[model samples]
Target: MKRAGQQGWSTTEYLAILTGLVVLWRSSQLVLEHLAEHHDEFSWALMIPF
Candidate 1:
């Protein structure tokens, strides 16, 4: 049925978005750590995210 197909599509879309968010969060943590160690060098750049 059309409703079942739509549900399947939505489930896949939800999973894709969830995965993307996890990847972004992990990368952001890494970037923040690196910037923290070199704070003086990227002080202005850090403001963009904040």
Candidate 2:
């Protein structure tokens, strides 16, 4: 079904969403780099036997 006057996201909303995604990606990159550099201090998750 469709509506004649229905509208989708505006340009500003799209830009805001894109900007948010970029921030999240960059933050994750920084965190991962930090963790990798200090690999000896932090350990990976251990798997327990079922």
Candidate 3:
């Protein structure tokens, strides 16, 4: 079996990615809540994927 560091992601790298994801999730939730509070003034457009 390959060690974590040897396989490319060390423990620190995993922790960093996890932390970043958590931050992003929290920020997105805040933004959505703000938009919901001011739905009349804020609108979100969905982008269509080709």
Candidate 4:
């Protein structure tokens, strides 16, 4: 069987990608929260992710 890391991706590369995704998710959540607070009407849809 082929190993998962055999494609040349190292630990550091994986960590960096994970960190970037976390940052992106947090930033988006903050923006959504702000909008939900100030724009009250559409707040419910924000949590739906669509």
Residue 12 miss distance in model 4 (angstroms):
0.4
Decide which is better by TM-score, 3 or 4: 3
- Residue by residue across 1-50, what tens digits does model 2's lDDT show? 55544334465678899999999999999999999998866664434444
Once model 1 is optimally superposed onto the true structure by TM-score, how far is the C-alpha of residue 16 displaced, in angstroms? 0.7
lDDT agreement with native, every candidate: 0.92, 0.78, 0.81, 0.83
Judged by lDDT against the true structure, how good is candidate 4? 0.83
Which residue pairs does candidate 1 place in steric collision?
Answer: none
lDDT of 3 by residue, 1-50 (tens): 88866657676788899999999999999999998898866444434444
- Scored against the true structure, residue 20 in model 1 reaches a CA lDDT of 100
Q: After superposition, how far is residue 30 of candidate 3 from its true place, in Å?
A: 0.4
Which candidate wins on lDDT? 1
Question: Candidate 4: TM-score?
Answer: 0.59
- Candidate 4 structure quality by residue, lDDT tens digits, 1-50: 65777645676688899999999999999998888688877766778965
